[model samples]
Target: MSTALVLIMTPGLAFFYGGMVNKKNVISTMLQSIVCMVIITVLWGIFGFSLAFGESFHGFIGNPATYFMMKGMLGNATWKAAPTIPLLLFAMYQLKFAIITPALITGAFAERIRFNSYIIFLVLFSIFIFSPLAHCTWHPDGILAKLGVLDFAGGTVVHMSAGWAALASALYLKRRNEANHSPARITYVMIGTGLLWFGWFGFNAGSAFGANALAVTALATSTTASAAGGITWIFFDMLRGRKPSAMGTCIGAVVGLVAITPAAGFVTVPHSLAIGIISAVVSNLVVEWRTRTTIDDTLDVFPCHGVGGMVGMLLTGVFANQHVNAGNTTGNGLFFGETHLFLVQLLAMVGVSVFAFFGSLLLLKITDMISPLRVSAEDEELGLDISQHGEKL
Candidate 1:
């Protein structure tokens, strides 16, 4: 059930990214979002899942020999990380996460990347970037897990990696030639946001690994955070003298979802509200700040996902309560008279940011050598829809 809901988020993302680009590149933008679903699915089935979830290797990555080609995932055995469910089900659930991670970076280079080159990057990122992070954070005996770092879902593994990669991609790819333009379709964005909002219940709640109190709490927190984020962004926009915008609301809501993901099961409902509002405000400031710069992070992925994920991780360290979930291996936060978790989260954030940013930069350069990463100047001006995919609507 949860796997199905999470899968819908990719198409939701497609529409969300598609609507934000200009008409000339709309189809190519959506296709980038959708294609990862196809490519990553195959990669995950082969060895990606093992690299992420198989037995540990020096506390850094999983041992591929354990489940290469998913050799031992069949039948009714439960996974070690999530006991009580079929092992295969757990693998399927994580696959949804793998698909979306690369898809999210598409927004940063939406209009100027070569389609074939993007396909290569998608595979490379899943193996080198996403898999190692997932192993360190989510694997039972991994490094961050041993350090008591808490990421209920994937603030580090998914959002932070994608956010840093988005920044790297924007910097490496450089600015788009076309000037900033209006969204091609506000209606498409609205529809996409609605789909994303609906699917997020599964994204957060399902992380609980069962239909239980924690899942219910996560569901409640997800709803509260998104609502708070959306409203807070509107107020911030008003303060800046810009009219309230449909696109702004949609982006804000998604930001809230990203912010709450790491902290949902650990923090209480009230703190979730704070997480949403503060993250929205901070991301809004960053987006505004970005306008005066030359870095073309086309859709503000770093601001909304990277910075928002950081805010959530910080707040999780601040607001987490041992009483909320007794299963917490890490103890309470500073508010509860402990300072260890907060410091650990900071270190983890810095480490992951360095890894993802430099790792993605290296991947971009490597992939460029294999195949030029960007479209030709003439093809870019002609638009990716006509130049790369040879299709238009």
Candidate 2:
């Protein structure tokens, strides 16, 4: 059920992003996200999962041989992370995580990238970038895990990495050519938002690995944070002299979900509320600020996910209560009378931001080499649905 719920998020994301782009590009934009379910799934089964969850290789990556072709995962085999479920089930669950991370990057370069080049990037990023980061942060013996970075559910690994990669992609791809641009369909965006919100409960709570109290708390915090975030973003819209909009409210709710992910298991309901509202306000400001800049982060993925992940990580260090989850090997946060965790979270965010940004930039270059990264100007004007796929509504 958890895996099924999370799988829905990628398609949800496709619609969310599809509706935000020009009508001519809608099909291509949605396909970019849906395609990850295909490419990343194959990659994960062969080696991506092993590189992330197999035997640790010096705290940076997994040994491909440890679970080659997912051997030893049948029958009574079990993983330490979730001893209650079969190892195979756990692998599928994590595969959903792997699938969505790259899909998120599509939003940054939706209309302009060559479809073939993006497919190549999907493979490369899963193997080289997302796998290693997942290893470092989630593996029990991984370096950052040993340093006590508290990512209950991939705040750093998923959202932060994707956010940084989105920024790198925007910088590399440059601006789109559209002179008069507006979303093609806000109704699609609203429906997509609802699907994303419904799936997120599983995304956060399912990270608990069992039907336990931690899962319950994660589910609770996720809901509270999203509500607070939506309200806060609308308030910001009003303060900025614009009417509160459905689109803005939807984006705010998703931002809250992103911000609460890393800390959901460690913080209380109230802390989640604070984290949501604070992140919404900040992301709203960043989106507004982006309009004056040259960096065309088409969907504002960096400001929302990247910044939200950073905020959640830092606040987790601030509001973490060992009483919520006694499993925290690291001491409590600054609010809990320990400054070490806060500093550690900051350092982890810096390291991840640098690695993801530079790594994605490099991958984009390599992908460009493999197949021209951007479409020709003629193709761009024709729209990707027509030019790339030979189809259009």
Which run of 10 residues does model 2 get worst, by summed lDDT?
175-184
lDDT of 2 at 134: 92
- lDDT of candidate model 1 versus the reference: 0.91
Query: Tens digit of lDDT per residue, candidate 1, span 58-152?
Result: 88998877888888877777888799589889999999999999998888988999999999999999999999999999998889888888999
- Candidate 1 deviant stretches above 4 angstroms: none
Report the error of model 1 at residue 139, Å.
0.4
Give model 1 RMSD, 1 decimal.
0.8
Relative to the true structure, how large is the alpha-carbon lDDT of every model? 0.91, 0.91
- As for candidate 2, its clashing pairs are none
Task: Record all residue pairs in model 1 with backbone atoms less than 3 Å apart, i.e. clashing.
Answer: none
**lDDT by residue for model 2 over 182-266, one digit each (tens)?**
9989998998999999999889999998899999999999999999999999999999799999999999999999999999999
Q: List per-candidate RMSD values in Å.
A: 0.8, 0.9
TM-score of each: 0.99, 0.99
